[model samples]
Target: MGTKEQLLCLLESNRERYVSGEKLAEAIGVSRNAVWKAVNALRAEGYEIDAVTNKGYALSQENDLLSPQGIERFLPRDHPFNLIVRKLVDSTNDEARRRAIEGAPEGTVVVAEGQTAGKGRRGKEFFSPTATGIYLSIVLRPALQADRAQYLTTAAAVACAQAIEHVAGKQASIKWVNDIYCNGKKVAGILTEGAVDMESGCFDHAVLGIGVNVKPPAEGFPAPLGDIAGSVCDADEKALRNRLVAEVLDRFWGLYRHLPDRSFYDEYRRRCFLLGEPIVITRDESRVRARAVDLTEDFKLVVELPDKTRLELPYGEVSTAHA
Candidate 1:
């Protein structure tokens, strides 16, 4: 742990009361001046730390700041993953790809405050602004063969839905493949991309990118997305971000360790939004209007078309005619 993290741990450990600067400096083996600098830095990062003349400092319980220190406190004491927090990035998924190519271990996570080029399925642009959402990507090297890789996206959707429910205390549902919804509006999206070794026919690594609208933009969403886009919650920004990230990693890692089995299938299907609903699937120049009937074992959407035929569509943009 660095000086800032050490100081944060001390304050977080004693969040209810003041911890003397002298004692903090002694515990962390730093001078009082260094402690003051650390406090100032933390304050700049949105931590609400109190300082008085006689009393040293007390960290407010609602010190909702998104940082390595804040996230680490909520994570297990001895986590094995490498967590990279960035102020800005083109995309967390892109960053994870760069890291994976350079041999970043499985479970490495990249989180950014903002994304300049956020992405969604079918090459769509996800509306990502600064500081009001959760943008993160996780790197995984599963032992399964390349054909089974699609399950990762399914697992990611389930993990994200569960995490959102756990943190926001609200129910969340999922669209066919990667979109998560709350109250019938799109609140989050998942994009899963994989790199394969041609000769071995196995995946080199896979990156799962997730973006959730935790808070609304000051000006609200753009005209194109304004009608469909929505936030998962309007709670304290930093506290929600920290808890959501930790919970997602915890839930994802647990399901990932048992991949190809897809034990989350039952829960995932239960939370699906399009089951037995009239829908349209668009691909290139083709479009199919159908009734979504079920989600299959392989994560495909089973639908009944106007021709009275059952079709299992693997991927497409599903939208209700009524919407």
Candidate 2:
């Protein structure tokens, strides 16, 4: 890591108290001049750092800028993540896909504070305002057949929901296939995209993209999403974004390693708000009304049609009939 990165980790770890320049220099094996330079650089990048003449420098407790070091401070020292953070991007998923095509390994993560063209399921626009949301994507090379790739999306939903609850102290629910809800409104969405090796019938690589509304936008949600969108929390706590990113990766990594076991299936089913509710299934141009009855072992939605015919939906879009 560069001097700036080393300094960031140290500051984030000691965010609660100020550390003298001499102490920081000694801890990181750098000179006081270098420490001062790094502090200025961090401030240039939008970090809030306070400098005191005798007490020294301290990272502000309210600093919410996203950084690899900030996220790494909460991650395991040996975690297998190649994290990249951007002030802005067109889309984290698009960036991850490009890296995957260029031979990026598993655990490569792309995170953006804001996106110009955030993507959602079925190519819909995901509202991703700056400084109030988390938009990230992970590149995975799972050893699964093409037919079972949906499991990745389902697993991610469970992971994200668990992370939101743990970090934000809020109850989160899953909306059928790939949405996460809080307080009866959508708070996050996951979109999994991948390519299958035609010869082997297995995935070449999969980019699992997740977008979360950590706090409401300053101007509030757009008119179309005002009724359906919500945030994980109303208070924008410092380090909230960094902690959330690490927690999500940590939880997802555990579930991903045990993909063959499908242990997360139970949690996904339990949190699914659509189960037992009357829903409208949309496939292309046709729509049908059904009551969500259960979830199959493979995470398929088992719904009973109006005629009392049960059907297992391997994949499709669904919404509450009253939505």
Candidate 3:
């Protein structure tokens, strides 16, 4: 750990409690000036640290910056994952994919404060404006067939919904395969891309990209998304982003250890916002109106169409007027 991380650990371990600069320097074996500089750096990164003239420094319960130290504090000391945070990126998913191609191991994470070219499902451009949203992607190498890659997206949806609900104190629901909704509007999206080994019919690696609207952009969303796009909370943006990211990674890893099973299916079905609701599924030029009934153990969506036909679809662009 570097000086800033060491300082962060000390301050975080004693959250909202005063820890003198002298004590921090002594604990980290750094000069007092180094501690002061580290504190200033953390503050610049959006950490809410309070410095008292005589007493010490106190870390607030909430921090806005997505510090690796802050995130690691919630994980094990030897957490196997490799995490990378960027001030800006074209897209975390793209970056993770490039790294994966270069032999990046599973559980490698790429997060950006802003994405210039973030993507949604079906090649749609996800609107990622500045630091108000979380744009993250994780690299995974699951020992499964390429056909089952959708399971990663399903797993991410469950993980994201649970994490948002837990950290934001708001109810979150899954919309079929890739969307998360809160307060009757879409709040998050998941995009899972797989790199397949053609000869083996297996996935070499998968990049799961996630974007959550934690707070609205300064001028709000574009006119095209005015009706559906929305944010999850108005609380501290940095705090929510850090907590949501950490919780999603932790929870997803726990569920992933037992994959190719139905452990996460029931919970996913329970939180699905589209369940029992009328929806329209668009694939190419075909549009089908159906009532989403349930999700199968294999992550397929079961819907009852208008003509009383039951169909199972693995992918589609979902829209509904129910909300």
Candidate 4:
């Protein structure tokens, strides 16, 4: 770690109190001038650092900027994540895919403050504005067949819902497949992409991309998404973005480690808001009205058609049907 990173780690660890420039300089083996420079640099990058005569410098509790140090502070000491934080990227999924192709290990995570071309399910664009959302992708080299990849998305949705509720103190529900809703509006989305080993018929690697709208944009959402989109919280809180990122990673990893056991399946089913509700299943050019009944063991949606014909849908866009 460089001077800036070291300073950041120290400041984050002592967020509850101030650290004098003399103490900081001595701890990092740097001069007071260097410490001052680092503090100013962090401020330029949106960190809130208070400088007082006797108290020296203190990081504001409200500094919500995303940083590797900030996230690591909340993660367990034995966590398996190799975290990378970027100010901007085209897409975290794209970045993780590139890293995976180059042989990045499992548990490598790429987090971006903003994404120029954030991705969504079925080639859709996930709106990612800087300073208001969390966009991250994790590289996983699961030893599973290609056909079982849907489990990754299922696990991620449950993890996200749990994290949102823990941090934002709100009820989060899942709209079957991979969308998370809060207060009846879409707050998060998960897109799982991967490459398969052609000969072995197993996944070489999978990238799980999760994007969350932590707060509404300053000018509000775009007109097209105004009615359907929402944020995790009504207003920004102290370290809200960093906390959400850490919580999501912590919860997701807990489920991912025991993926074969399917321990989170029950929670996923309980949080699914579409169960037993009339829904429209859209596949290709056709839309069928069906009542969602239950989820199969593998996470497929079990629906009852109008003629009482039961069907299991492996993948499709679903929406609540209106009268």
Candidate 5:
């Protein structure tokens, strides 16, 4: 662990009481002055530490640090992902795409506290007010056929669901394609973009972007979306933000290592709410009413027509499979 992380860990493990500078110095093999310096550094980093004259320092238990360095301390050592925690941005997905063009390594994460231009599935406007949401994106370079790329979206959806459950103790559900639902409302969304490599018949790189609404005003949502949207926290942003990032990334990394697994397809479908619902989807200048028959792993929508005949619709059509 780095010096900053070590100091933070020490403070966190003994949060109940102050750890004297002399004792801390003895334990960490640093001088008392050095311990004092470390404490100052943490304070500078936005950690609310109370410094008592002779008693040393104590981290305020109620202070939840969601800063980049603070989040880094909670991650696994030598984690195979580059995590970028931003205070603000135009959009995490847009930033990740820019990074991909610059040849950023796979698993490079771009997370922001707010997005000025956050968007949702099907070209819907995303509301990401400042310090009120978790907007995140990740770059991935998987050598898989385009035919197999559909599973990547489902994999990421499951990752987000699993992450939310672990971090917030909320049982999140997936609404087909890549939307996470909790408590009868939306919680998060993911978008995937890729570069096709025809020569090698594989995708050179893919970027999966996720935006989780951690907080907003307590009045529910705004205007048209008020009835359709909700937040994880109507009061606490810090706790929700940090936990969402840690859990989402942790789950994403696990499924990403396996890439496009069909076994997870069943589990993902079970958590879906899109299938079996009466819906009218616009496909190529024609709107068709079909019952969602089943969610196929190939990114095809099995929607049964009025005659009960099942027709598989490619994900590219039907606007977006998400509800």
Candidate 6:
């Protein structure tokens, strides 16, 4: 933490009472003048730290940014992952890929406040604006093989939904592969990409990129999506980012450890919204519209067609009709 952040934390911890400048200086091992400067810096950042000469400073209740410190305060005391926070990046997934190549351990997470080149499924460019949402990626090396890779996306969806519910106290339904929806509007998205060395028994790593539009757009949503997409904090800038991040990490830690358990599979299947719903699978020229029925543990989709014929499709092959 920087000097300003340390001072902010001290004032926030003592929000109920005013802490004297001399006491803050002694606690933070800095001069009283240094503490005063730090308080000034914090106040500039939209924090309501009231500096009363001789009496000391008080952090007035103010808007909190979705920065590292705000997010970290909500995390468990001993989290499994480090908060590798960055101001801006081309992509968090890209950063995680670089770290994974350098022999980074599992559970390493890379979070960027903004991404200039965010990506979605099938190389689609996703829009990520500054401090408007969560742009993060988690690095993992699951024991499953390529055939079972899509389940990671499913695991991610359930974790996200559970986290959202924990934060918003509202349930979110999963959209087949990598999207989470609430009130029939898009709220979150996940992208899972990994590489494997064919000769080696172990896989390289997989990076799950997640982006949630927390606040409603000020501008620049694609023309086609203007009427459909919405954010959780569209009405409130002070969104559920902090709580959701904590809940997501907590949920993932539990599931990742017991991934081989059948209960994990059961839980994911139960939350799949596409199952038993009418859907369309359009791949360029071919479109197969049917009722989505089941998703195997290996992440294959079994759909029953209009003619009562059954088609077993891979989860990778389709998009669904609107909810």
Model 1: per-residue Cα lDDT at residue 156: 86
Candidate 4 C-alpha lDDT tens digits along 126-204: 9999999999999999988888888899999999999999998989999989999999899999999999999998899
Candidate closer to the true structure by lDDT (higher is better), 1 or 2: 2
As for candidate 2, its clashing pairs are none
Per-residue lDDT of model 6, residues 40-145, tens digit only: 7766765666767677887554444545555666677777786687778999999999998898889888887789998888887777887677788989988867
TM per candidate comes to 0.94, 0.97, 0.92, 0.98, 0.82, 0.88
lDDT of 2 by residue, 273-313 (tens): 99999999998999999999999999889999999999999
Candidate 1 residue lDDT tens string, 36-151: 99999988887799998888999877665566665666688777668888878998999999999999999899988889999888788888887788899999888767777668
Q: Which stretches of candidate 2 lie over 4 Å from their true place?
A: none
* Cα-lDDT of candidate 4: 0.93
**Stretches of candidate 3 above 4 Å error?**
44-48, 60-62, 235-238, 321-323
Total residue pair clashes for candidate 6: 0
Per-residue lDDT value at 39 in model 4: 92
- lDDT per residue (tens digit) for residues 107-171 in model 5: 89888867888866667667887656677888988878877777788888888888777777778
TM-score, predicted candidate 4 vs. hidden true structure: 0.98
- Residue 87 miss distance in model 1 (angstroms): 1.1
Q: Model 3: per-residue lDDT, tens digit, 271-310?
A: 8778788998887898767888878788788889888899
Residue-level lDDT for 210 in candidate 1:
92
Q: Which stretches of candidate 4 lie over 4 Å from their true place?
A: none
Better structure of 2 and 6 per lDDT: 2
How much is 89 displaced in model 1, in angstroms?
0.6
Q: Determine the backbone clash count of candidate 3.
A: 1
lDDT of each: 0.85, 0.93, 0.85, 0.93, 0.75, 0.76
RMSD of each: 1.8, 1.2, 2.1, 1.1, 3.7, 2.7
